[model samples]
Target: MSQTLQAIYAAKRKARRFAVQGIYEWQMSHNPVHEIEARTRADNAMHKTDLGYYHELLSEVISNADVLDALLVPVLDREISALDGVELATLRLGAYELKEHAEIPYRVVLDEAIELAKHFGGADSHKYINGVLDRLAQSLRAAEKQQAK
Candidate 1:
């Protein structure tokens, strides 16, 4: 990957981490994204460079979340709404890439989510996340092909 792309992914990983924390907060209080964004920003416990990336990513994902979740439901036979906070948000982040940021190869997006799932989500969550993302990537590619024709 180019340095810029690597920087972007670094931003995305940070975003994923922030997204996890924000999602957890949303679940707890059902707060709006704007409020959560402000809160996450208000603290910034450290003067860290990495936190900025995560903060921006979390903001984007949270802001676009309704549309993102809409894309997820059809792929899942069960109501994904009932999924754990981390799993649901992780899927949203991957879906955001698949649906909105098609510039990134679908496989790479899925890979990022799988890596996150393995590290952060529960046992077997990686497998579950992988399955959903694989299907999502295929759909995204198919849609792109159709749009091209």
Candidate 2:
């Protein structure tokens, strides 16, 4: 990749990392989303992250959590309550991208979520995250998936 593209990719990855942590904090503490965003920003090296994408993911996912869960629940092997916090947060992020960010390919959403799960969740959690998001993409991005074939 070119230097500029690599920098942008790194920034986005950092954003996803911070967003996952912020979402995980929100899930565990039920704190207000803005507060969580503020606290996360204050604690992190914000210049290295994609602040726009981080804000979008953190705010949108928290605000639309119920809707995201409703879409995810059907694809899950177990109940939503059974999901680990990290996996749940990652899945929520993926679901939000799949649902609201159609400009992003479903494959990219799933790949990013899987990477998040591997980095933050349990040893085998990426598999579960992958399964759920894969199923979600099928329905949520049916048109895109069809066209890609």
Candidate 3:
């Protein structure tokens, strides 16, 4: 890939990392999305972060949390409420991307979510996340997946 594309992808990955923490915080504390965004910007160095993607991921996931959780219900082995906060946050982020961002390939969403879980969730949580998001993609991106195959 070209250097510019490489930069964009890196920035997006950083955005995902930040969004996971922000979403986890929002889930735990019920903080307003704007407050969480402001606090995240103030507290962290977002030099190369994709600010637009970060804001979208954080806000959309919080605003449509119920909808996102509903999408997760069937694929999740346990209750959504029973999931570890980080894992839940990561799944919601991945689900949002899978359902809303059709331009983003499903495999990319799954991979990113798994990476986030590995970094933020308990040991072996990445495997669980991979399974859940893989199932979600099957339904959410069935057409795209079919084309890819």
Return the TM-score for each candidate structure.
0.75, 0.95, 0.97
- Model 2 RMSD in Å is 1.1
Off by over 4 Å in 1: 1-8, 45-56, 143-149
Task: Give the TM-score (vs. native) of candidate 1.
Answer: 0.75
Q: How do these models rank on lDDT, best leading? A: 3, 2, 1
lDDT of 2 by residue, 1-149 (tens): 89999899889988889989999999999999899988887877799889999999898899889999999988988998988899999999999999988987898888999899989999999998988898898999898888889
Q: Write the per-residue lDDT of candidate 3 for residues 1-149, one digit (tens) a residue.
A: 99999999999999999999999999999988999999999999999999999999999999999999999999999998899999999999999999999999899999999889888889999999999999998899889888888
On the 0 to 100 scale, the lDDT of residue 2 in model 2 is 100
The deviation in Å at residue 15 for candidate 1 is 2.1
Question: Model 3 off-target regions past 4 Å?
Answer: none
TM-score ranking from best to worst?
Answer: 3, 2, 1
lDDT of each: 0.75, 0.90, 0.94
Predicted candidate 1 versus true structure: per-residue lDDT over 46-90, tens digit per residue: 333366656655666777778877878778757876887778878
Whole-model alpha-carbon lDDT for candidate 1:
0.75
